[model samples]
Target: MAWIMLLVAGLFEVVWAYSMKQSAGFTRLLPTLVTIVGMVISFVLLSAAMRSIPLGTAYTIWTGIGAVGAFLVGVAVLGEQVNTMRVIAAVLIVSGLVLMKLSAE
Candidate 1:
């Protein structure tokens, strides 16, 4: 249950990040609201998850999800350039997360 909450929190991190981008420096009202709400929920879930998961591990996975999800969304929706090195870095982040999760189990 805690792990599931962590996963959902990680996904909320992604939504918050994406909404931040869309918020246009907080100039856009709707996106700004979404960003605020998402961030709050994300943190709430993260705190809950931390009751079971180690702080360092949970934090890294949360940020990793946000980073990778933001990068992909930027490329797909915001016309950001896709580069080999960027993709490789994202892959490495994911690999590290997987390794940590496996080791935890």
Candidate 2:
């Protein structure tokens, strides 16, 4: 349950990040509202997940998911560049996330 909440929170983190970008520095109303709502939900779920998951592990995983997810979204949806170095960096982040999860066990 906690992991599920954490995953959802991480996803929300991505949503907020993308929405923030779409918000045009908060000038846009709808995207800004979506960003605000997404951030609140993400933080709430992260707080709940923290009750069970270790702080370092949860934070690392949360940020990792957000980072990689945002990268993918930027590439796929926003037509951002996808270079070898960036791909490798994302892979390293995912590897670290796996290591962090393993260490938590």
Candidate 3:
């Protein structure tokens, strides 16, 4: 399904983001390769999802999911700051994504 593909793409977006950080400006060989592979897979899935879903809607959802997921990962796994503003902003992003999905129906 298009939604499933979008979700997978979003998940890969997070993976690639984290892998890119680990790549250390591409100085690390394994992580850099992983990042490149993840990025390609992510974009491919995104394109596949777009075949069935409206471009605007799919892109917004994909980016929203990826951004929120990555932010949570950074906070929970990387011990990044989970400040009040950041939390509120993330909540807003998720709310907007949900609203978009609902409205698209």
Candidate 4:
């Protein structure tokens, strides 16, 4: 249950991050509102996950999920440039996350 909450929180982190970019530094109204709401929900879920998960592990996993999710969104939806370096970095981030997950006892 805690892990599920953490995953959802991470997904919300991606939502907020993408919405933030669309918000244009908060100049846009709807996207800005979405960003604010998503941010709040993500933080709330993260806090809830922390009740069971260790702070460092949960934070690292949450951020790793967000980073990977946002990067994929940028490439797929936002049409951001993708190159070998970007792919490699993303792979490294995911690999680190997997390692962390395995190491968490």
Candidate 5:
């Protein structure tokens, strides 16, 4: 349950990030509201997950999920360039996350 909450929090992190972009320096009311709400929910869930999960591990996983999700969103929606190094880096991050999960068990 904690892990699930963490994952949801991480997913919301991506949404908030995208919302921030759409907010355009907070000039847009709707997007700005979305960003604020998303941020609050994301942090609340993250804090709940941290109750059971180690802070270091939870933080790393949360950040990794958000970074990867955001990167993928950028690539898929924004047509961002994906070079060999970027792909390799992403693969490495995934590998590390998998290793961490495996070791935790």
Candidate 6:
């Protein structure tokens, strides 16, 4: 359950990140609102998950998910570059996430 919350929190992190970009430096209204709301929800869930998961593990996973998720979103939605180096970096981040999860168990 804590893990589920954490995953959801991570996803929400992605939501807020994307919306934040869409917000255009907080100039846009709707996307700005979405960013704020998503940030609140994401923080709440992350706090809840932290009650059970260790702080280090929870934070690392949360950030890792957000980083990778945002990277993918950038590539897919924003049409950002997807070079070999970037791909390798993402893979390394994912590998680290897996290792972190394994260590926590």
Work out the TM-score per prediction.
0.94, 0.99, 0.96, 0.97, 0.93, 0.99
The order of the candidates by lDDT, greatest first, is 6, 2, 4, 3, 1, 5
User: Once superposed on the true structure, which residue ranges of model 4 sit more than 4 Å away at CA?
Assistant: none
Q: Write the per-residue lDDT of candidate 4 for residues 12-67, one digit (tens) a residue.
A: 99999999999999999999999999999999999999998889889999999999
Positional deviation of residue 2's Cα in model 1 after best superposition, in angstroms: 1.1
Winning candidate number (lDDT) = 6
Greater lDDT among 3 and 4 belongs to: 4
lDDT of 6 by residue, 65-85 (tens): 999999999999999999999
For candidate 1, write residues 1-105 as lDDT tens digits: 988888889889889899988899999999999999999999999999999999888888888888888888889988999989999999999999998887777
* Candidate 6 wrongly placed segments (more than 4 Å): none
lDDT of 2 by residue, 1-105 (tens): 998999999999999999999999999999999999999999999999999999999999999999999999999999999999999999999999999999989
How many collisions between residues are there in candidate 6?
Answer: 0
Clashing pairs in 5: none
In the range 1-105, model 5's lDDT, one tens digit per residue, is: 999999999999999988888899999999999999999999999999999988877888888888888889889987889999998988898888777767666
In model 1, residue pairs whose N, Cα or C atoms come closer than 3 Å (at least 3 residues apart or on different chains), thus clashing, are none
Choose 1 or 2, whichever is better by TM-score.
2
Steric clash pairs (candidate 6):
none
TM-score of 5: 0.93
Worst 10 residues of 6 by lDDT: 96-105
Which pairs of residues collide in model 2? none
Please state the error at residue 71 of candidate 2 in Å.
0.2
Residue 54 deviation, candidate 2, in Å?
Answer: 0.5
> Which of 4 and 6 is ahead in lDDT?
6
